[model samples]
Target: MNRCLSGLVGILFVSISLVSCQTDEEIKRQRYITEGILIFKNNCANCHQDKGQGVASLYPPIAGSDYLRDKKSVICLIRYGQQGKIVVNGKVYNRPMPAQPQLSDLEVAELITYMYNEWGGETKLTNVKDVTPILNACKK
Candidate 1:
């Protein structure tokens, strides 16, 4: 009976330890994705829709978009807004996407992380450390 109890305890401890072993980077990535969802709902949902399917002939879809091929341009446009006509998946959208200058570099990083993970076929975080320099350079 004693040996059985000890073995059970050891197994439980190992299980708990394994469950708690998630890397810090993964934790931060999850947090960024959570915040990004809220940001999108508040700032982008009206035109882009909740699932990023876009509004007919006006806004462009973000999910499965060919436009996402230009990561740099996507990042720049998020902060500086977009003008003129743009094509997405062979459809032309002429509406202006107002700039979200209020979003901090961190917020942009979080947003991109969420977007890429959810739709851009990415499985990694887009760290704020990487986003700041890009944002700084795009400031006009």
Candidate 2:
């Protein structure tokens, strides 16, 4: 009887643990979205607009930007801002967006995750580990 009770308790414990873990991804996704939205509003909303639609040829749209579609390039550019000119979404945006080195890797990841999931782009759930290498590889 004791053996059966112990087994039942262990199984119950494992079931509870698994159930708690089930929502971790969703929680992380929500947290990333929240963090990204805050960062964007604070730093990017002025130029990118609240909806990520660029400011009429001044700033380029971030929602469906080609730069974002190329994940590697976008990650690199974010880690190290590009100068000169670049074309995004069939339009040429000439302004230089300064690199956000002050932001932590986790913050940057959350920002990227939010951007990818938000607006009209593909929903990619980015994490700190996912983007850390990109930052490390950047020459700055």
Measured against the true structure, the TM-scores of the candidates, in listed sequence, are: 0.90, 0.78
Q: State the lDDT of candidate 1 residue by residue for 1-140, as single tens digits.
A: 69999999999999999879988999899999999999989988888999999888888999999998888788999999999999899998897899999999999999999999999999889999999999888888
List, residue by residue over 1-140, the lDDT tens digit for candidate 2: 69999999999999999878867777888889999999888877887899988888778898777777677677777767778888887888798888867778888888888888885465557878878887788757
Which regions of candidate 2 deviate over 4 angstroms?
A: 1-22
Stretches of candidate 1 above 4 Å error? 1-12
**Model 2 clashes, total count:** 0
Given candidate 1, what's the lDDT at residue 35? Answer: 98
The whole-model C-alpha lDDT of candidate 2 against the native structure comes to: 0.81
